[model samples]
Target: MNKDLEKLACKDLIDLALLMPKKFDDLRLNDAPILNELNCTKVVIKSKKQLAGKRLTCIAYSYNWECECTITIFNARPFHNALFAINKELLIYGKLNDFAGLLQFVNPKIIKNSGEITANYMIKGVSDKSISEIKKKYLNYESLKAYDLLDEHIKLLLTMSENSSDAMLLLNSDELNECLKFVEIFHHIRRLNETYKNDTLYKKLKTHDINKWLKSLPFSPTNDQLKAILDIKSDLENAKHKIRITMGDVGCGKSLVIFAAALMTYPNKAILMAPTSVLAQQLYEEAKRLMPGFVKILHFSGAKTKFMQDELQDANFVIGTHALLWADISDASLVMIDEQQRFGAKQRMRLKELATTNDVNPHYIEFSATPIPRTTALINSDIYSYSFIKELPFKKEIETKLITIEQSKELFNHIRIENEKNHQAIIVYPLIEEGKTNTYKPLESVIPYYEKHFKNVYYTHGKDKEKDNVLSEFALKGDVLLSTTIIEVGISLPRLSIIVIVAPERYGLSTLHQLRGRVGRNGVKSYCYLLSKNEFSDRLIEFSKTLDGFKIAEIDLANRKSGDLIDGDYQHGASFKYFDETSDNIILQKAKEYIHKLQDK
Candidate 1:
């Protein structure tokens, strides 16, 4: 064994067995000496000699056969001449030929060392023949039995390689290959999850403490929210270094979970980092009002806070925007990040590092409003503890509609009627001001038309100086707010009833789902109108039928190929390397269950 192979990450025979081949070739001998079949035979070179210019020829016999097996080796090196001398015994594996009145082996790999197979393991950037030998030595039914994996799944795994005695009888070659793919993917995910062992770091959370805090709130938590809190609570209680990512639809009441996390980590200094000032301010206000008064909560955003810096540091719970990444809150034992996708890999990892102490990492919880596929959530389990709040706490009555340029008049009439009812309306244009694209009308171009029809019409975009104030105004007294997708997160507009998106095809379904979430907070019938002209309109039309953001995520999975998975930026979504997140949930669930069982053990 070389140093490189000895250092391979394989812990035991199971690792060797689980290294599935990217492909397999048939080298099995036929019942008889059938021509055109790849065969392996033991032979003695009866007449062997070097020909012109590295060409070597040999006549070999196997199994006391009368027919001579002619072997012509091309580009023979010096070692080949020494090894294939007259009367030397050899094992030849290659394509068998019936060219003339003779049986022949062409370009055969003379197996001086049996079980040696060339393979590319990918991790080492080098190829090794010893891998085949190792697989042969250790990859067996008993080796699988030692791992304690699901019996059915393991049987499926071996059947893919045709290792089971009756596997081929049950499945044809094509069927086996197809089913074997699931097996290979199952192992790939299993190996990724196995690395999470031995990394638990956190103190147990008391449910009674959480119950006491819940009593302080005016409203009760949703069952899904409570389930999420319980999962987080269990993780906090069991591990020292906790990593959990909470994903839910926008307006699914994730703030309660964030506040609950802070309350659960009471007296241990919980710090929260939100993506924007508006969201940070909103969460800060919620925490201050909902949490126990004696807990001492503070908000810091954009600059040094009005409160004394020491007070900010010493507070039981602190909420801030990106300013939190640099805030010196070393007493922090729990760190929660809101709208975590707004930050890149460097910033998220930096917060984790900053919150961490010398002995253990702070229990980290990340909150995202983007709903992801269940398999995607499972894949992410390799790095983060995943929890989903898909069931809405409050029923959102938003009905989606697909409209085109021709339907502009009816759309305007609906907005006019909604506004006349004192119900607020938002028209979200793709562009703040039209520049490059001509297909979509910008806000500046259309505001005049909207202002002419509706009263108290105001407009704002992401760069608006008074965007928060504008949103505040629209939520209160304004009848119509013509804007961009700036109101996607954190604004609770209970009166806003309709969101009309122009050129809706330009935005992903997730963003549109968030924009649609702005309405229907108070269970009033809310409407989402998607205006587009391209053939891409069908997706938006399909999107309008369901209100489930998680279902929209499934459509997103099929429409958009996944992005990078390396940096943990699942916001744009990381592509699955092996399994299809859409079709492979069964395997994903099994892998998750297997890894979770291991963690428990």
Candidate 2:
């Protein structure tokens, strides 16, 4: 790679080919020059005269037009005087002007050749000549062929590299942009495959029958859940290691799938790491109730070290928070992470490393309730296998409303009625303390009012050390809970019937969806109120129309014009130069089809 090319962040042949020119200079000879426009013509210097202030004036005779034209060079140096000698044959290119009815060329440049167009680049610290040289070396048929690009794409890029009329024709065509978008996605998927192909399983996992266990369950599993289980079964039985992400909507029974995976890895051990201790305990309780009594299930958190060490040796399924990362364990064949996006990459990698031994990696699976758009999921399927569970175990009936401060009396009355029914309500504030720019009351300022009117009021924030305890206590005896967005994921509140978000317009649609999901967990009537000073918000209005998290994600993507609403790690900083996640769905589909064909071969 050239040092100058490296400065422009060109990493490969594809990158070099995609470095499009900002503009092109057409120096082709013009037979008929237009007045007050840039023209190129062959000319001969008939006479030259030096003026005051180092200016030179030359009378040039144009061969094509058969006319004499005036040429003026400002601040003319010694080279300029020498070049414009008497009767010198040359090609001049510049803007022709009519100064007082006289045809003139002001500061016209001498062109060595007048039949070819030239490309001009706009990169800082890199000259146009250097960029042209780099392109000539890398953006060729042979070089692009080595990267397995299609012939059509390579030819289009080659034409773009050359300075010609054909290059301009292709540059303005839609076919060229589509080709570039396709190649960008194709190259990204290939790189991701190569990066993930490094690890393999030492041996295929032994299959375990889940039919008997399914029959033992109290209710029938949804078809999506069954399919996800089968996908995991196939991955476990393969010699090649696979990493799969199973995304489900809120209260979509993902815990059942987690339990099923544990059942498949019965004799061998399986481990699940959750983000919060409250969620870990919830899954632990569900596992104990659902799984057979024969399986040894253990829950580890901030408890004593000796107790955890003793149970770690023989436990079939261990569920815990980040405390699981520090525990010593070996020979585990499966690792599952619930709410996988909550943990950093290093934290997830550390948990996976604890289970890896004998040069064999465990089958990794991530479970997330953060739903994404279907198009995005399809695009990312090239990198990782995905299973979506959009079907809820039970249809949720939640009334979402947009409210204002003028409706405070009605909002307070609704809260009181829900409280009178022995149901719980939660109010989420944007901040803990008031700031200069705050338009709504902070949690601290409003705590007094809630405490005076509502009995058994509990409050917590993300930075509170005892938030877990507070949440647990609130779930048991509290009538109202006040907190930040920390309750966005993981704690199952069956009795939570109402969730009022102060300044709801300040949050993303997906986040509002997740927060709304906290209610109506157990098929009870629930309500979500969006309290804002503004009477109307398009995003909030759209969010209140549906309870589908995936659709909410699409709306959010459309409003933000960014893919960062999805997992941040998968986006690679959302820095795609050509591929637009918002509007390039068709191009992505074509690229995926092509890559699939190659994989089949």
Clashes of each: 6, 0
Q: Which stretches of candidate 1 lie over 4 Å from their true place?
A: 1-198, 203-213, 240-242, 247-252, 305-309, 340-346, 373-375, 379-394, 536-538, 569-574, 589-601
Q: lDDT per residue, candidate 2, 1-601, as tens digits? A: 7675577777677888888888777898887878977789999999999999999999889998998899999999999978999889999888999976777999988888888788877888888777887888767788898877889998898989888888866775799888888888787666656655535663478967888999889999999999999998988888885568898877888999999998998877899999887888889999999998888998987676557787888898999888888888666788999876567656777888888787778888888776444224433546567788988888889999888889988988888898898899999999999899888888989899999988899999988999989999999898999999999887878999999998988886767887898999988999999988977777788889988766776776656544332233542235467887768888878877887788788
lDDT (Cα) of model 1 = 0.71
Task: Name the runs in model 2 displaced over 4 angstroms.
Answer: 2-5, 27-31, 34-116, 210-212, 218-224, 302-313, 323-330, 344-350, 372-375, 378-380, 534-539, 557-573
lDDT of each: 0.71, 0.82
Question: In candidate 2, which residue pairs clash?
Answer: none
Candidate 1 lDDT, tens digit per residue, 507-591? 8777788788888887888898888786555667778888776678778766664453333555445344446666766766666
Superposed Cα deviation of residue 546, candidate 2 (Å): 1.8
Task: Say which candidate scores most in TM-score.
Answer: 2
Task: Tell me the TM-score of model 2.
Answer: 0.82
